[model samples]
Target: MRGTVWVASDIHLGEAVPQTARAFYDFLGRARREAGTLILCGDLFDAWIGDDHALRRPPRWLATALDELRATAGALPLWLARGNRDFLMGRALADALGARLLEAPAVLDTDAGPILLAHGDEFCTDDLAYQRFRRIVHTPWIQRIFLALPLGARRAIAARARARSRQARRSKPMAIMDVNPAAVAQALRAAGCDTLIHGHTHRPAVHALELDGRAARRYVLPDWEFDHDAPPRGGWIEIDAAGIRLEQL
Candidate 1:
């Protein structure tokens, strides 16, 4: 990007979290004025059962969120990637907001340099149960079957899955939930990039790694939270000719 590129992920916007929605709207406005390109890495919505839900008969909260996204997209370049929670997001949603759909583990040639971007969940290879669940849900045929269901049914199924996922996380070991070192190494090598950017573990930090006799770095994007937290915690990565830096929102 010419001016500046801004990246963010895991907003998890939903009807239940009005404060988060508003905060995101504010962020969009700021981005329009400050950045030339804005990329939402993933999980922009808390639950995206299907694109049809928002395109056909969107609830009030969804409608408002769409409006904000549309405005931001109109003002600047917007690229969205699929997160675990909102992987159902498709071209229909992207078309509606004038945004481009980004594939996971995409490489971006930015002003700073080439960077690898992803939603981050795929690196948690240690979580066998989650990996199995991901395989099932991500299968093309299974996704088609799920999408063919009635919208109400899909919503119910998604809600149930979310509940079960929460329960499972409670009993799982913390280490399993985080990214596996081997998985990260494999991904970076496959992409042929030294820098990796993603969001899913929600634990935001920068890690320096030695890979294939070369130095590499991984940047974890923060998950946005405004309702449950006391002071509201959120941030984004800003990239320019100088370098990339995380800025608090």
Candidate 2:
């Protein structure tokens, strides 16, 4: 589509993250009228186990917010990517909201330009171990097995997994928590796209890198965190008739 799309990632919505949850809700309200599409890069939820997580007796605010958005978003396209945290999301919810689940390294024709969208975690080549593990967990067979587990069990396992990921982060080098510049260039080269937008490292910056002897822009989207001072930064990459603008409202 030749129109503006709101792009953002690393929401990690839920699990008592009230600030982020509220900001996302507000962002959605604005995007409903502002953009042609809403591209949620990944980690839409802190941890989405399955459809049962959505129907739990103990209603969660995130689930309610999602339902409300889905209803209000109307015909606007909702495109989602599977991120490190909310990889468990599937077609069940997608069908409910008319959302599209994007494959890894998906391409989007933004009003600004043709851009490559990724979760950005796979670009952390410095963390070779995580790369290897990501491959295994991403396989169809493994994903199927995980999806078959009871929702309660899946929820429990997810908590433990997050704790383990935290432990690993504490032990690993700082670079492991960030994207590898070489990997980013490699991905851009393979995708044959200059602009790459993703959110994972939580480092929000516009990086200019050389790809195939040509200059390409890689935008790192910031995660939703309210502890910061300045107007509660981290929103969407807004593109209008003029060009792309980062709206931190």
Candidate 3:
């Protein structure tokens, strides 16, 4: 996907956040009308135990979100990327939604220029525990075992994991949770790209950095939360010939 590219992530759509889902649906409508290609960077769902569970028996909320995504895909190129929570998303989910699965750390040759894209959690090298947990859960055998379980069992397990994660975050230092500078620099160098765009830290901003005696920019995407928060928040990054810009909901 090139030309005018629109990227968003960390929407975390689920049963609880109807307002957020609605806001995202609206954004999809806008993207269909405006964007040349749309890329959902990651975490489009709060949790995705398995694609079978969602496709076989989608609740009202999931159905609506899927429909919205399908509608958007029908209008333009729609790409989905796996996030930390929705790492289980597979080709089946993308096919069902009429979208294509996008590989993380992908380099896009866009109108603005070539830019590296990622989900961003992999860059949080400061959090040793989370990185260790990430390694365990990402094991192929472990994931297959988890997905083979019953949907209800998977739901219970996911609930417990989420609870534990929230509790753990309460005790962890804030800096540890964000991406490490060294990791970011390494990723940019490895990818041979000067511009990096990602979501997961929920700290949306364009950071200026020096890499190999040259300028580099990292764009962090914001997470969406509209139901309980005092200020409803959501946004996306737009890349075009003009420049890269952030738009808010």
Candidate 4:
């Protein structure tokens, strides 16, 4: 094909150390020219809640920056998956952007093959508590209620939720944040896909595995970082006719 399909995830926009806005906008400029479709794995925002298009609240230069991408990416397909953080993205924003919001375990056809895309949280078979919570929260009834809450209320709830999540993460082992190998195999087999793309663990790499009767490849996208106490190890995923490439800013 003549275009590239950009895949990136875990932008985590709310962090204070440094923002990925600059890198993200820079990538958008290049991706618009080369990518026919852009798949955002998940966690596009650091802390997002409510369905209203409150993106006007983006930090001073951020909103204007993103508008440039909208202009350049006109009519290009942008498929976005929701992470634990941005689960609030709803129809209104998708309609405005002319993009599609994909749920977890999304199956897609790419120049590469029939591929599976997900946030990868559901495949963490080891995290029993989180899996249970995810089941309840992702249910249609709970999601509807959450989306219907006033924006301010949703924001407040998200704040508390985030705090608790941080505490839990501290108490849990590192392995709990990663994908389960057996679960990965099972999921790919069910989707009948030979490739999977996901972002959640923040450990970016390309992995190969034999699942079902076929071999499968998994690409783990990375989170963006910036110049702070921690050097900017910012990362992203990109695929073009030349092949797939990943760069750390």
Best by TM-score: 3
lDDT of 2 at 36: 88
TM-score of candidate 4 against the unseen true structure: 0.87
Which runs in model 4 stand beyond 4 Å of their true positions? 15-18, 53-62, 65-69, 227-229, 240-243
What's the C-alpha lDDT at position 146 in model 2?
82
lDDT tens digits, residues 1-249, model 4?
235677888877654633567677667777677668877777877776754635546555546544654565475777768888887777666666667777777786656556788888878889998888888887999988887887778878888988899899999999987899989988888898878878888888899888766777988888887735276666776666455666666
Stretch of 10 with least lDDT, candidate 3: 240-249
**Candidate 2 residue lDDT tens string, 1-249:** 477878888777775767777777778877887788888888888887776567555367866776755854575888877898887777777776778878768877666777888999988888987888788877989877887898778878889988888888899989777888888888888888998888888878888888878888988888887644555667777655666666555
Model 4 global lDDT (CA atoms, 0 to 1) = 0.74
Best by lDDT: 3
Using TM-score, rank the candidates from best to worst: 3, 1, 2, 4
Least well predicted 10-residue stretch by lDDT in candidate 4: 53-62
CA lDDT of each candidate?
Answer: 0.91, 0.78, 0.93, 0.74
lDDT of 3: 0.93
Tell me the TM-score of each prediction against the true structure.
Answer: 0.97, 0.91, 0.98, 0.87
User: What pairs collide in candidate 3?
Assistant: none
Clashes of each: 0, 0, 0, 3
**Of 2 and 4, the candidate ranking higher by TM-score:** 2
**Per-model root-mean-square deviation over C-alphas:** 1.0, 2.2, 0.7, 2.6
